[model samples]
Target: MSVCVKGDTILYGSDNYLKIADAADPSNPIEIGETSVPGDIYSITVRNEYAYLADIFNGLRIIDISDPSHPTEVGHYNNIYYTRQIVVRDNYAYVACEGEGLKIINISNPMKPLEEGSYETPGRAYSVALKGNYAYLAATNSGIRVIDISDPSDPFEAGYYPTEGYAYDLTIQGFYLFVAEGAAGLRIFNISNPLNIKQIGYYDTDGLASGISVEGNHAFVNDGIDSLFLIFDVSEVYFPQETGCYKTATANWSSAVNGELAFVASDGAGLYILDCSLAPTLLQSFNIRQAETKMELSWDISSREGITGFKIYRTTNEEQPMTKTTSPTIPITASNHYEYTDNDLINGKSYTYTLAVRDSDGSESVIGERTVTYKLPNIVYLCQNRPNPFNPSTSIECTLAEPAHLNLSVYDINGKLVKT
Candidate 1:
C-alpha cells in the first residue's frame, strides 16, 4: 500500500480500494470517502480534481475526487504489467510497472488514457521521478535508470546508476537526487549530469531505508526494518549527517512533509504526524504583505528555553545563497509578536524570506520560510471579463497603483446597475 498527500487530503491505496481521508489534523486522520478499484491499488498521485491509482494488474485507474466525500471512477487503462508507482506530469502519467519497466500514458483525456510509450528495464521498476525531459526510475535490482522522455511516444534509456542495495524510492531536489536504498541506507547522488550520476555521499541507517522526503536543508527518511524516522542535515548536498531520529513501533512505509509537520505512513501505526519545526515555536501566522514600495513580514512566537533571539534571511534567487538581512542579536521575548518591513526591494521582483532562531549557545535553527513577489505599478488597469460569450458567472479583474477608496460598478448591456 502507498499514500499521497495533496493539500489537506490524503489519498491512501490499499487492497482494492482508494480511500480519501481528511488530513486537517494529520495525527487523527478521518476517512471521508473511498472508491473500489478493479485490482489492488499500490500507489496513487493526485492532481487537480483527479486521483490516479496504480492498480497492479489493473494498470491505471482515474477517479474524480472533485467531491472528496463521494469519489467516482472516471477512467481506467489496462495492459500494463503490475503497476507499482505513478507520477503524473503535464498530460502524461508515468507508471513504474514492475517487470514491465516504465509505461508513459497520455492522460489529456481523463475518460480515455492511452499508452504513449513504454521502456522495458532490466529490473522491476518500483518508483519514478521526472526532471526536465528525463525520467528517473528506481528499478529494484537494476538501480536507477535515466531515460530521456523528451519524446513521450518513444522514450529511450540515456544512462543507468547501479546501486548496491534495492532502490525503493528516490526524490530530486535541485541537482541532487536522494535515494532510499533498502538495506544500503540513504544514498545521495549528484545528478547534475544524469549521464554521469555520481554517488557523492551515503548514510547507513540502522534499518532498511524504505522512503524519503526532502525539505529545505533536511531529509526525512523512514527506516522500515528498525521502525525509525531519521532526519539528516542535507545543507551540504554531498555529505549528509544524521541530526535526529524518532522510534516508531510499526514499520514506516513512507513520509511527506507540509510546512512544519512530517506525515508518516506506517504499516500498522496508521499515520503519524510529527512536529518538525525548529526552536521558538511559531505561535500565530507568518504573513507577507506588499505595500506601495515595501514588503512587510510579521510573525508571532512562543518562547522556548535556551533561545537567544531571531534572524532573518532574504534572497532574490532561490538557487543562489541568501543574505542575512537581520542581526543575530535581534531581541525576542516570550509570547511576543514582531514585524519587519523591507523597503530595499525592487518592484515586480520575487524574494524569499527565511526566519531562524538562535540559542544562547550559538546554535541556530531555521523556523520557517516564505516567498513573495512584488506587484508592478498599475494605474487603473482593467481586464476584460472571462468567458466573454455567456456563462452563469464570470470574473473581472482590476488593478490600482495606489490605495484609494474608489467605487467599482458593473452594469448590464442595457446600462442597468447589476453589481458594484
Candidate 2:
C-alpha cells in the first residue's frame, strides 16, 4: 500500500481500490470515497483535481477527483511491466515500472494521458524524483540513475551511482539527495554536480531502509523489516546521524510528511501518524528576545540523561546555508536552562536561529527555531559627511527605527540649495 497527502485529503492505495480520506484530523483519517481498479494499486500521486495511480499490471490510471465522494476514471495506459511508483509534476507523470524502468507520460489532458518516452535501467525502477529537467530514479539493485528528462520524448541517462544494497527510494533537498539503501541504510549524495554524483555520508540504519521523506533539516525513513520509522538529522549533509526511532507493529513501507506530522504506511498494520514536531525529549522551552542591537536566545532542558550539551546555529537567508554560532555548551548535571546572546548584528536584517541537543554518543537532534528581525535604533540619527572638504562624491548615512519619508537637501557655500 502507498499514500500521498494533498491539501486536506489523504489519497491511499490498498489492494485494488483507490481510497480517498479527509485528513482534516490526521490522527483519525475518515475514508470518504474509493474507486475500484482492475489491478492492484501500488502508488498514488495527486495533483490539482486528479489522482494518478500506479496500477500494478494495469499501468497508469488517472482519476478525476474534483468530487471527493465520486471519483471517475479519466484516462489510463496499460503496460507490460508492473508500475510500482508514480510521481506527477506539471504536465508529466513519471512512472517507475518495476522491470520496464522509467516511463514518462504526458498528462496535459486529464482525459488522455499519452506515453511521452521511457528509459530502461538494469534493475527494477522502484521510485523517482523529478527536479528541473532531470529525473532521479531509484532502480532497486541498479542503484540511482540520473536521467535527463529535458526532452520527454527521448529521456537519456545522465549519470548513475551503484549501491551495495537495494536502492528502494529517494528524496532531494537543495544540493543533496537522500537514498534509502535497504540494509546499507540511508545514503547521502551530493547532487550539486548531477553528472558527478558523489556519496558524501551515510547512516547505517538498524533495519531495511525502504522509504524516505525530507522536511526542513530532517529526513524520516522507514525500516521495512524492523517495522521502525527512523528520523535523521541531515542538516550536516556530509554527516547524517540518527536522532529518533519509532517502532510500529507491521512492515513499514513508506512515509509522507505534512508540517510536523509524519504519515507512515505499514503493509499489514495499516497507516500510522507520528508527531515529528520536535525531538523525542531533552527540550523544554526555547525562545529568543531582541535587546537593542543584539539578540538573546535561551532554552531549557527537562532531562539530561545521556545528553552531552547543545549547539546553536544561525542563518540570515532561509535558502542559504546555516553556520554554527557558538561552541557546544558544557554539559551540566544540575542546570536546566542556558542562554546565549548574538551580538553586533547588522540592523534591519532578519535572522533564523536553531538549537540542537547533542547526545553522549555523538548524535544530534534539532529542537526548535526562532526567527527575529533586528531593527535600527528607536531615534533617528544622521551622520556627518565622511569628507569635510568636498570631493566629487561623499557617503551620507541615516538610520531609522520606523518607516518614514524624508528629504535631504545639499547646499553650497553660498547657502543656496544646489542638490536635493
* Residue 179, model 2, lDDT: 93
Task: Kindly list the per-residue Cα lDDT of model 2 for residues 1-420, writing each as its tens digit.
Answer: 788888778887778888888988877889999999998888888888888888989999999999999988989988639888888887889999888889999889878788999999889999999888888999988999999999999999999998888999998888888999999999999888889889987888878999998998788998989999999876556557566889988888877888888888888777888889764434557789886556888888657777888888888874468864576574555778888888757778888887777778898766667788888667876878888666788877765666689798888899999889
lDDT of 1: 0.83
Give the Cα error of residue 98 in candidate 1, in Å: 1.3
Error of 1 at 301 (Å): 20
lDDT of model 2 at residue 327?
Answer: 68
Off by over 4 Å in 2: 280-303, 308-420
Model 1 compared with the native: what TM-score?
0.66
Candidate 1 lDDT, tens digit per residue, 31-91? 9999899888777888899999999889999999999999999999998988888899999
**lDDT values for all models:** 0.83, 0.84
Clashes of each: 0, 0
Where does the lowest 10-residue lDDT sum fall in candidate 1?
A: 277-286
